[model samples]
Target chain A: MTDAASLSAPEAARRSLVGWLLVLSLPLLMAVMELSVYAVEPRVLSLRNIVNVLDQASYAFVFASAQMMVILTRGFDLSLGTSVSTVSVASALAMTGLVAAGAPDALVVAAGLIAGLGVGALVGLFNGGFVAGLGINPFVVTLGSLNICLGLSTTISGGGPVFNVPDVFSRLFYNGKLMPGVSIPIMIAVLIGLGLYFLLNHTTFGRSLYIIGNNPRAARVAGLPSRRYLMFAYLACSLLAAFGGLMLTARTGSGEPNLGGSLMLESIAAAVIGGVSLQGGVGGVGAVVFGALFVTMLSNSMDLLEVGGYVQQILLGCVIIIAIFLDRLRQTRA
Target chain B: MTHIVDRRGAGAVSQRALRGYARVGFLPTVLIVLVVAMALFVPRFLSVQNVFNVLRSSSYLVILSAGQMLVLIVGGFDLSVGAVVPLASVVSAMTMVWAGGAVPGQTGLIIALGVLAGLGSGLLVGLLNGLCVAFLKVSAFIVTLGSMSIATGMALLLTNGIPVYGMPKAFVSGFGRGLWFQLPTAVYLAALVVAAVWFIQNFTKMGRYLYAIGGNLHAATVSGVRTKTYLVLAYAVCSILAAVTGLALTAEIGSGQAVINGQLTLESIAAAVIAGVSLKGGVGRVEMVTLAALFLLILTNAMDLLRIDPRIQTIFLGLIVVLAVAIEEMGKRRTPVD
Candidate 1:
């Protein structure tokens, strides 16, 4: 059940039990903190509050999962916010017509998913091609792509939100309920989490990704298509970003051009704080999910405590610095 | 055969330089061509007032690029520059606004405060970045990326997510209004900073160490060069420059805005890298960076004149960046990395 059993000895041996413990302990500690806060503010333990937290955190989960891929590849994608905007706009446009045509609910959902995934793959291919072919740094490549994506999204949407998403898809994300009173967005998060975990650990491609991230040249010598793997990583990131955007639109019932703006840094912060090394080749899907959830809970707790925005941001900053410090400590230990 | 081979080798050397100039100098060349082309085709391109306008718009960018260039030269980056300057500027401006009502002659005093705050903020962050990389041995990318968040958060914290303005006339007015020879004092200050950077890069022992470390870190360490100290100094210099840029920005805009860092961070990095500063570090000129900034200014200005959508303009910039990287790779393959 732990998924630790599937990991090869070389990988497991490289990471001591302490490294593994830190990974699990950080989340547990945060959960404890969450519970302690709930003790003082009993309202936080309410089903509605948990539902709200999960619903709000679903988008972050998606974006952070995408960012985790890039980070796992020993790279980062700053264009994700823009990609989300672009994909959401595109998907909204796609969904509008599908619903208007009276398409089947399942068909509408499939179309939206396909549109998002396709846009994501296209954007990722552009980034991966340049990064792999020209040897441009991922930072520079993604930075450039970020602007381009933003510009494209803005142009396509004409500097406005793309609204009127199909009712069928929206219901799947927002209106659907699970287990009597729990919301459906939490289910989406779980599905994404499970999908990413399987993709990251249970596949040869994922193993190759880990190897390539640790050392691209070594991976290439090991007969891995390092370039193609990097491409897949970027593609996977963009697809997740697009999915996050679609989910955001579904939850809100509209595709805002800037819906996922702050999610960019928040996603990176969550992943980095959750113990995803920016250096690549380390971290798991579970860590990324926990990272996103932790930040979401922090924000929720702060809101419940009536903490002002400025103070909240300051606290967030402090948390980031501490997380980074811990991450550095962990890396050195390894 | 020997004579023929010599001639071929000589021909190859000059060809290589020509290509280097094209790859490294592409933007400036394009800038010069565009300037000349515009001056010839349009009546307004060469007027003194228009030139002054370009310079005024470019002044803060010069300061920003100068700060960024030092780090670029040393094979590191400071993504936090965009956030740091805005944070410092907002903090200083908020303090100025608060002080303007309490005392006379407060504006001048606050300007000094702003300068000190800018320098102090840069130095602190830069030192933090340096320590993370040197002592903690974490990568520069992570440290700076983390700093970007920290600085932006601090900025947001300073004002509770609101813009701070309405400062007394005495503080920003002088620097904002003060002009020399029909040009802003800010432009002059930027010029001074640029000159200082040019001199430091060309003449200082520290500058040499920067190049050495960038070219080969292990070699520099083996040669007994205290690289960590130099990297710390480099980041410190970069941060101070960012602070100055921020101060100048506040003077120009007359207020502090948090949203400025989103894309401008990459712009400065792009301008620095486009100036032919090797990503591997240790191979660039400050003059080239200044020229690259100028080129970007001209290009963006041209796009504005052409009435192109800002989004398309960004796409064009992305293409240029990709192409520049391609050309650089091709050049290195032809020359080899040794």
Candidate 2:
């Protein structure tokens, strides 16, 4: 809706300033939270606590990034949480089965990763094909897939956690560090975030995706391969989610059929709070990172303050509503 | 009658009937086939007890789907209905307990107060959702999603993550698990809701305005329709009916839990859509949606009878929804102009 070509230089400057302010608001919120927590207990603001919060935010960052890609192209993936669960179960099963057969550690890990990513890719392909090729509603398609994935995960795991994964797999992927005080999850999340930032800001595919989301008809008229781009968006989203699931498996040292509970909603919340437009064609990786961090920190601070989980849920709902209200104001002004 | 018969012959009359069936859509045909197949294959599938059991179990879903149909007709979604069910149950159960203790031996007063409290909770949620979607101009999905979370939180808070016990014995047995005229009491309640919704959808000015609004908001606004009021009314009615379902379920289950009927939100939407309710708005029927809900119930019931795994049953449900929507899409493409 904000046409770049039609805006005057001064108006554009003002709009960009507002956008920057919105992005900065996440960190600003984080600071406010820090102050409040410090007021309650200064010891909670230690450097160690900050690192722990970041560690907690690692999964949020990954899931939010994955969600941001699909949202950028004007699609929703309600199946992300279930898909992650499926992937976790699949990969864990593969590693455990291979290990039981006396396979080497490297082979077991490779097989697990491949099985997990492969399942993710298949789910993505199904979603993309229905939404892009058949033109079905994204919500319905993803909703259906969400159920299917949940069923598959539960069925394969027989309604329990899959265990006995190779220890080396977790060590190399989740626990190992290039240096002390830096976790593998944090590194993976950062690498994915930076990779997406570059891809979104510096590539023709990314620009075309923006144009397509902004106005699909115009993109088609201008000869953009909108279908392929949309398909790739869903595929990439599921793949990223799958990678995150693999990391979760490594962290927990097992395949949890219920892994990433409520993650679909949380990731969407993070992306939306970080300034990603649900209507699409607006947002950045930087905004989403801060958004994920802000959400993680809010929960962490609440835990420190001994807030009930129910209250946290209520506050989260309120925060999402407020964030969207602000987003509407920004849009109208722009 | 003779003249009509002479003019249209037998073939023409059958053709007209076939056309009417087409207009009603393929759901009925599918339902019939599924029913016949199950009756033939599954033992005891046609017994009176099993038939009544299916109807009893599907009553809640039927009511919820009728409510969902109202919202779909207005081009909106209410994901919060699932959360509202539990919230209503918890609030009502808690109220009943407190009131019963306050007024010892006043069973009637306690039940009435509980029902009122339950409906009030639903109304509050509905009002918030409707106001946000109508006045604030927020997307219905996001507003309902937020309310869903809020409502779930409220339910959990009220019950402290535990089920509320101590419901009046008479209330639970006479209403929740009662039989009336050889059918479950819930069936009568479900029928009353269906009839009420059907009447509103067909014979009310507000319903017509809602249809006009959903069909084309700009045109309806130009034609002097109060689009906002009708939209809110639709959402409110939807939530109230969901609340009714919650009350019935609470009585049946004999407790108020935080997570009762979590799947109803998705299931209700699926039933409406599968019954040929247009998500794009301005189209749906109460009878068809009720029938669709029954069909879904029967499908699950049959699967259970066949000793199928519950997980596989979930997969079947998901596949059926997608397949139905895909078929509808193909049908639309074939008829391009419409």
Candidate 3:
């Protein structure tokens, strides 16, 4: 387990240095880019503005971390964004009905939260049942489920945004300040990030994901419950997305059935940009945070530069392609 | 419920028929049954106008699905086609707008150029997808997914979310509204595509090579199939076909819009799967996929006549796709046991 035990000190140091350089270079470049943009617009680099930007990216961070876990297991769950939308819509609809019936605001808010999480679990089951149990390819299966979730959400909400959410819900999760300097949403995002870090590093199940991803058949032969763990990964991914949906609902103060549409691409782009290997089992928690932050800042700087939203999308696509190319190049070098 | 045939003693020809029956034949049979049942209960389910509607709708869907089918057959999935259609539509619409009013003598020249512009732009998209997936050793899913984002953004950038208007009257009427022998003009185009696809898949060496590659990439490479060339070719055809369909659709709509048909990629894959095109690749037929597209359109048309809500209909559509895939997986399991 001691990697440097048999290696010369210089050699070990060189190896570690290489790893650190690869991890730090991209994020450092991104920070410099943001700083340059900040130089152009002095207000953008203000501490408050920086906090606001991080807060905006916090929701996406939640989505990307969960997506990273799924990708680590050699599976992709495209349904996550739709799962979030569905959960958000379902919860909003439930809240509306409860409020209309004069239900207590506390109980009603609780009900909506539970309903959102329930939709996530339901989507997870639908995806996992086919992907793991039936051995269908996860990509196509999740695509089907993404459509299914979208259909269900629109059906429930009549294809319109649900409005009139109680203010308390928004106040608690959306833009509310947890303390003098901390935003509630940012706090929650960090807490979830920490939880994921621990789960991925300390838990046996998390280790199983890497093992299965690296070699599924070997893991199977090793008596791992590959299917269950695989299913669990999807569940975790969707559940996190669903939670992000709740935050989005609170932030917007409405439930949109189609809000998750762009999330599929955004989360994938974030994870990939962060240096998570699409080949799976190769990303670290620190890299993921950097990735999410880098992607979000890239957007923030673009906005500061007054780039049109559509043009920003094109830039994002370029980033994803370049990131993947870099990943491929590194693999060849190794 | 009744097992009428004693399948155990069936002869080789019949058993081959029966195995085929279990695989491809069953889906078409189910489609026929559903159509008949709908016809029995839903009025206008078989009307000429309604049937024409289904045919017209399916013409483009079948075309798009064929493109998807090509990539799927080669073991690479092209999600970029979903974006390509919108790109083609928007660009073509803009081209016609630039060409301005069609002079009687110059109309043909302009339309031809428009077609070239569309195909050429599509060629670029395909080239990017093909090169990345083939040479760069990138995953097909991510490459196409990345391209999809790029294309979608380009479509938006081209139009600023505004629909391009003032298409030449001749261009719209000829490509979109004109008909021959009581069939929409687009059907003829679709038929040409399907026939070309059939010819390519059967008569051409490249098409056969697709199967070999999909069947086993490493083995095919070792056997010297030039996988890089075919892989790029498959994606190129897939993206270009998607553009053709997009151009046709934009002409029909009388303008170019930025939004993509969200269901195009999913529906195409579903049709391919239901028609027995394995996602694992190296298996399928154009004829079966064509029928599968027709069946899906018919099913949707019947549902519309039956007053099913559109949103609920989407749920059913997704469920059926997943169900078809599950059934295919189960059938695969049964073969190992047999």
Each candidate's fnat, listed in order, reads 0.40, 0.51, 0.61
lDDT of 2 by residue, A1-334 (tens): 7733356988767666667566355677678778979998786688888888888788999999899888888788989999999999999999999999999988999999999999999999999999888988787788889889989999999999998878898997788867688888888888998899888888988887788778889999999988998899899999999999999999999999999678898888888887787787887788688789888988888888888999988887777777677666666666
lDDT of 2: 0.87
Top candidate (DockQ): 3
**Highest-TM-score candidate:** 2
Model 1, A209-268: lDDT tens digits are: 777777878898888888888888888888888878878878777667787677778888
Q: Which lDDT tens digits does candidate 2 get at residues B9-73?
A: 78869855755666787788899999999989876899899998899989999999998889888
Q: Is candidate 1 or candidate 3 better by TM-score?
A: 3
Inter-residue clash pairs, candidate 1: none
TM-score of each: 0.89, 0.94, 0.93
Model 1 misplaced regions, further than 4 Å: A1-25, A97-110, A178-182, B1-13, B16-23, B97-103, B106-110, B160-174, B256-261, B278-283, B336-338
DockQ, in order, for the candidates? 0.48, 0.63, 0.64
Clashes of 3: 0
lDDT of 3 by residue, B110-203 (tens): 6776767777778889999999988888877778888887888999999998998877677789768777888988899899999999999999
Ten consecutive residues with minimal summed lDDT in candidate 3 chain B? B1-10
For candidate 3, write residues A1-334 as lDDT tens digits.
1211234777546655556555456766776887788789887788988898889779879988878878887788888888888988998988888999999989889988999989988888888888888888787688788878878999888889999987888998886766888889889988998898889888999888888787889999999999999999888888888899999999888889988988887887778777677767667566678778888888888888899988888787777777777766554443
Candidate 3's DockQ is 0.64
lDDT (Cα atoms) of all candidates against the true structure: 0.77, 0.87, 0.82
The Cα error of candidate 2 at residue B7, in Å, is: 14
